[model samples]
Target: MQNMGGIFGILGVGCGLYIFYALYKLKSTGDITSSILLPKDVNPKTCKDKDGYIKAVAPKMAILGISTIIYGLMDLCETFVMSTGNFFWIVLVLVFVVLIWFSVTVSKLNKTYF
Candidate 1:
């Protein structure tokens, strides 16, 4: 049981980082369009190029939220019994990093997917 918790924590961290990397790539390598999936700069400031940045951000944000919720579940499952010990920081950092990773990934993904 203890080992499972530790493994889950590490898995959370890894998943988070992978998602972030994917988003970063999306933001940097995509073609610009007037879709709400990416930032305004990709759409240009002209009327024909106008895209609702806020609208584009919704889906990506939702994905990030989903990721965070998953991460919280991972933490809760791991912490159910062994709530204290030397591995506290591992669990703490893992959860927090999961959030940061997903947020970054989502931001970039929104531009591409929206």
Candidate 2:
């Protein structure tokens, strides 16, 4: 149980950092050909305005990444300070909510732009 928290924390923080770096590169380079969160079927070439689309999506993804790190931190808290009951379930549910919210938001963006 304790080990799981450490693993979740490390992986979540790493993924969040990677998301930030990728968004930076994407925005800096005007390269929207790929995305870590977006579906591959979301053709960048089909976007009405490439820069506009990137601007819209980057923030959403950044939010998701930040929430992921938060979830990870919550897991770490469970491992260290909190007990393994309500806090754990709460964090898990929150993470899933964040993920679903992100997904819905991105889908809306896709429909608007692509």
User: Which one is best on lDDT?
Assistant: 2
**Model 2 Cα lDDT, one tens digit per residue, 42-107:** 766777877778888888878878877877777777777766678667867877897898889878
Q: What is the TM-score of each candidate against the true structure?
A: 0.36, 0.76
lDDT of 2: 0.76
Output the number of the TM-score-best candidate. 2
| Model 2 misplaced stretches (Cα beyond 4 Å) | 3-5, 80-88
lDDT of each: 0.50, 0.76
Alpha-carbon shift of residue 110 in model 1 (angstroms): 12
Error of 2 at 45 (Å): 2.8
Q: What CA RMSD would you report for each candidate?
A: 9.8, 2.6
In terms of lDDT, the poorest run of 10 residues in model 2 is: 30-39
